[model samples]
Target: MKVKDKVVIVTGAGSGIGNAIAKHFAYHGAKVIVSDINLEKAKKVSEEIVTNFGESLPIKADVANYEEVKNLIQHAVTAYGQLDVLVNNAGVGPKQMAKTAEYTLEDWDDVIAVNQTGVFYGMQLALQQMTQQGFGNIVNIASLAGLKASLNNISYTASKFAVVGMTKSAALEYAKTGIRINAVCPGYTESALLDQLLATRPDMDARLKRIIPMQRYGEASEIAEAVVWLASDSTKFITGQTITLDGGTSL
Candidate 1:
């Protein structure tokens, strides 16, 4: 599909994988909505987009909150007059990873609240708008944990699995409406900012590296390229599918 002029909204666009996806979409000529709880970071991302000659809207939004998601959609529509793609990528991992027997309710609550419910709200709102417009693409970013059983982090795994399931269900429901839905599952992405947190727990981080067949972690940009294709018309025939970008680890 041609990339120019499409209006795309990317949640959690301020940093990490989300930031890469937003910038990639913008660089490819999509008018992007760079939404996040961090308005300052969003503005910086938007300005970077502008400096690179792409149209962007930097909006403050909390994907975990339903009202904020609704407002975000409103903001995007107000700025662009229409929306073509919605990338529901906002999510938070479990606060503390522990054996299920030792996991706290607070950790479970936080994971389900932000990762699972946030995607639902964004999907609901985006689908409503897309139905009215009669043409759109929705891409949710899931994790390899969605497919593989995760230990010591039950909540995050459960939420991601739900996202994958929801993506398929939504795609089926809207297949006849000219709306396409899909999910992308990425594995072992190396985030310097996030890895700083891993430094606090060396053992867990080491374990993560060992499971992947690719000893090295994947780059954020590699995942970004996959996301953009799913958002584009080139994958027009594909729907309700989960594309895994796991560096052959799943094999």
Candidate 2:
């Protein structure tokens, strides 16, 4: 019940880590706003939350677009009296693997639009509400790739690095305002994105296990747990930090 009665907005809550985080917050007694580009998927997650006797609202939003991002925050406020937590978890990867010099401009733009710019929109809009209320927490879902560069993942790495940097800068800016901003950098996790990445590098799964001390991929729920803790009052003094949940892969 760490987040009891709080109002939370989770972008990209249709599936994967986003979906798990949305449900986790609801189970902890928060009124969750489940947002995704796909309305159907958003509805399904929200319905499941309600079935568990948790409060939830489903909304369709593409975080890459500033207008849609604005509407998302507005809708959440309309549904709940105030906003307490925001998890910017929506992201995209480049279509193909390529060295930095050979990466396509189109892929770079697409990835940056969703992964970097989308996060910017969410943070700015959420800050407006939280600053007025004088309390809030934000958890941006970065990747271990943000901390350490990966082979042939130029776009994703760059965008996640931006997220990490932004988290620290923003956190410092609001440290005395009763607002905290932090990031979670997960390693290889079981998700549709991982599946897609594995498809490109057929031997990646085994390679990853050998490198990671845990010898296994992380679960979406595990990452969700860390997110909830950061969002809770338990970490009131913690800000401008990136929690790496990569099973020692980054080590």
Candidate 3:
């Protein structure tokens, strides 16, 4: 019940890590906003939460759009009467354009639009509300790639690094306020995105085991758990840091 009755908005909550975080928040008694670009998927997640007797609302939003991100916060505030937490979890990756020189400008732009600009939009909008209320928490979903680097996946790595940087800067900016901002850098986790990446490399699983030290992929729920802790009042003193949940990959 760490987040009990807290109003939380999790972007890209339709599936994968985002979906798990949304459900986790609901299970902990938080009012969850299940948002995604796909209305159907968002609705499905929200319905499941409601069926489980949790408070939830489904909304379609393309975080890449600043206006839509603004509206997302507005809608959440309208429904819940206050904003408490925000998880900027929506992101996109290039299919086969991981190579820097060979990648098209469109591919780079698409990835940056969602992974980087989207986080900015969410933070700007959420900060507006939180600053006014004088209390808030934001968890930006970064990747271990941000701390290290993934060959050929330059766009994603760079974007996540930006998110980590923003998290630290914003945390410092609002340290005196009752707001906390942080980033979670998860390693190769079990998700559709991992499946897609694995499809490209036949030896990925074995390679991951050899390198990760833990010899296993991180679960979405594991990442979600860390996010919930960061959002909770129990960890109010923790801010301006990047929590790496990478199964010792960084080590």
Candidate 3 off by > 4 Å = none
Q: TM-score of every model?
A: 0.95, 0.98, 0.98
Ranking the candidates on lDDT from highest down gives: 2, 3, 1
Candidate 2 deviant stretches above 4 angstroms: none
Q: List the residue pairs that clash in candidate 3.
A: none
Ranking 2 against 3 by lDDT, winner: 2
Tens-place lDDT digits, model 1, residues 36-148: 88999999999999999679989999888889999999988888888899998888876677899999999899889888999999999999999999999999999888999
Give the CA lDDT, 0 to 100, for residue 60 in model 3: 94
Model 2 per-residue lDDT tens digits across residues 102-197: 999999999999999999999999999999999999999999999997889899999999999999999999999999999999999999889888
Local distance difference test values of all predictions, in order: 0.89, 0.94, 0.93
- Model 1: lDDT equals 0.89
Q: How many backbone clashes does every candidate have? A: 1, 0, 0
* TM-score for candidate 1, residues paired by index: 0.95
